[model samples]
Target: MPTAATVPYKPANRCIYLHGFASSPRSRKAVYLKDRFAKTGIKLEIPDLNQGDFTHLTLTRQITQTAALFNNFNIPITLIGSSFGGLTSAWLAEKYTQVQKLILLAPAFGFPSSWFHKFPQAELKQWQESGYKDIYHYGKDKLLPLHYEFLRDGNQYDTNKLKRSLPTIIIHGKNDDVVPIEVSHQYISSHSTAKLIALDSDHGLNDVQEIIWQEIQDFC
Candidate 1:
């Protein structure tokens, strides 16, 4: 992906692009989606989740912040989110009928247990004792501390409660290590309106942006 890109004029109907954990609004994917939408005269909102605060970083807080930004706009939205952002998007669509369409890119759903299990006993114990652990921040080019509360907050949300009414599509990497494709499958099993497209890729799925972008165009 390009290091940077330019965004043009805004449009009435907007789309929100929520980045993943330890990511930023300036991420390449975020800007790519922003620049792409700008060409179609559709606005994109990419908020700063960290915003100088990492002590209370969690899915609930992120979702609240995103909802606040989304509420400012009166128009309906096409919600697109990556990883943890995708999980947030799913929750938002469950509560708000204004979300006209929803698209998840390798969404991090049902990962509370998966997260805890991924780490060994010693590492998990360390994370619990310290209350936080440093993870790579792709935007800042360094390791940033993420509070353990992030996982705790994620666990509280039951994905099975998702409302099956809205039109939603999930694109997941079959080889995703962070969030498995089976999680998305579980999400799809609940809703007939939901569709899952499993691609032969990894967690990033950066290699198939063209195909995913085409699907996004077709979806809208």
Candidate 2:
């Protein structure tokens, strides 16, 4: 039998990365984090929430799908979620005690209430009546059809109130147009244990990749 000191080493922690809406494991941010963290003996798991079924993609369904993957971790895990994925991570962080920390990037929390106002009243009415509407997916480079049910699902998960005691770090851009910096501020205000890092970049935050990497490395 081999002595404990001579045994092969194993990483004690896991990293589960949840991608944003309409995005996949192939997203630039996901790949970048994977490459950076791999050198430290950490491999990230990025799940495809859509699972080849975009028609039924809702925030609730995505949460369920992501939870399944996260629940399998027997050791402590750090969750890194971006945009819509950030919202999903909130729900998981609230439910799973195995998660040690949450890192959210421009989380699209508190968005539904404001987004509904973006479309004209007539367009909104038509979408509601039609049951489904086409929306452009930047990650996929294709127009995806989403149902109104997604909004109904979004209403159920309030990121501000979920796991308010969980340790969290939020990285948000001051110039974010999609989710807005105010929302992230509000989230941090409500969650006493959460910290916010405000940057001058846009929602993409591509310009500050090195900074983000350093923060993550420090946190891990």
Candidate 3:
């Protein structure tokens, strides 16, 4: 993480970077934003939110922490949340008036309620009793246990309510499996102020840093 300069200065624009679940502020996107904004003297704050166990903290706790972090800053804030962070950002933007701009990257539209619906109550109980240890393999990345429960809890935070008539940008990959691009389209269609940008990359969009930065610059 980059240290904030000690110079007594006010930023022209204030931005908050929210990393995905199980991810930290040291993520590539957070690092990229920090480096990009350093040259322009813009303040970008990325706070650590992972509390050891994902299931231990509730969604309200996450939202409260995020809101408190923003409350400490005295400037017009723009939130950029990726994946699970994106869902949290949407909730914050809807609840907070200081959030002037929002940028969501591959945000989950809804929870995996349908998939879990098929499981019997006994099976679900057994799964939960087993510590919810479900390993998910995504290419070379291995997701740990309790992630499914996190997603299940994440479903309670409704994304549809966050569709406000405010300046919003939804950047999603066309081939994103984690979060379908159609969700972005649906969000844009529902909100008149939202703009959807479709990219040819995957959910991470790790290869198109420059393009993402340019889009953010334009929107900001």
Candidate 4:
């Protein structure tokens, strides 16, 4: 319910940053933002959303937890969401008027339904019936259990309808195998207020950290 216009820009400068799924506030990007913005009085709000069994909650609940960070903050917010977090940012931006800008990095436009298709129908059905399944890998040894219904529910949110003409920057890796770069391109094509920056790396954009940071600074 906290609109962007009402959020106080205490210290008169700063922005909020959100981390991706299966990742904590201690992620590389989050740390980078915090360090980079500290000199400018810009604070980053990176919450931990991976404590419990993530697959048990619905996507709405997951999204709500992320959006709640903005509710009490008095400063102007510029949301930066990566991967699944990016999808969450789209929903938050649609509902909240307080978001000044949005930065999406290799965002999945929709759930990676195709990845599920690799499983046999019976296996997929069994996983769905169980309400949980290890769907993907996160980092080195982390396995991501996904709730199919949660993805189905999240897909209901139409990103196109949340048009606020807010400045949005999307940076995607050209060689991304997880969420194809084409998805970001399509999003930018449909949203007149959005811009796209393509990198030569993969989904993680691991090698181009400095360049990506530079782009973010320019946009903000």
For model 1, state the Cα shift of residue 32 in Å. Answer: 1.4
- By lDDT, the candidates rank as 1, 2, 4, 3
Residue 96 error for model 1, in Å? 1.7
Give the best candidate by TM-score: 2
**Candidate 2, after superposition: displacement of residue 192 in Å?**
2.3
lDDT of 1 by residue, 19-73 (tens): 8877788876787878887888767888888867865688889878877865533
TM-score of 4: 0.84
The candidate, 2 or 4, that scores higher on lDDT is 2
* Residue lDDT tens for model 2, 1-220: 1111221223576788888888888888888888888887778888887788776788878878876765444566678999988888887777766666899999988757765877898998888899898988767889999888887777776665674456689999999988898988888877888899999989888888888899887766
Query: Each model's TM-score?
Result: 0.89, 0.90, 0.81, 0.84
Give the lDDT of residue 147 in candidate 1. Answer: 85
lDDT of candidate 3 over 69-128, digit per residue (tens): 764444557889987778788887777666778898887665445336646878777776
**How many clashes show up in model 4?**
3
Q: Report the lDDT tens digits of candidate 4 across residue range 1-220.
A: 7744644433354466666766767777777777877766666766666546666545577578866766554555677888878877777777776666899988867564644555799987887788778745453246777777765676566655656666799999989987888878878887889999998999877688788889988987
Clashing pairs for predicted structure model 1, backbone only: none
Model 2, residue pairs in steric clash: none
Ranked candidates, highest TM-score first: 2, 1, 4, 3
| Candidate 2 Cα deviation (angstroms), residue 128 | 1.2
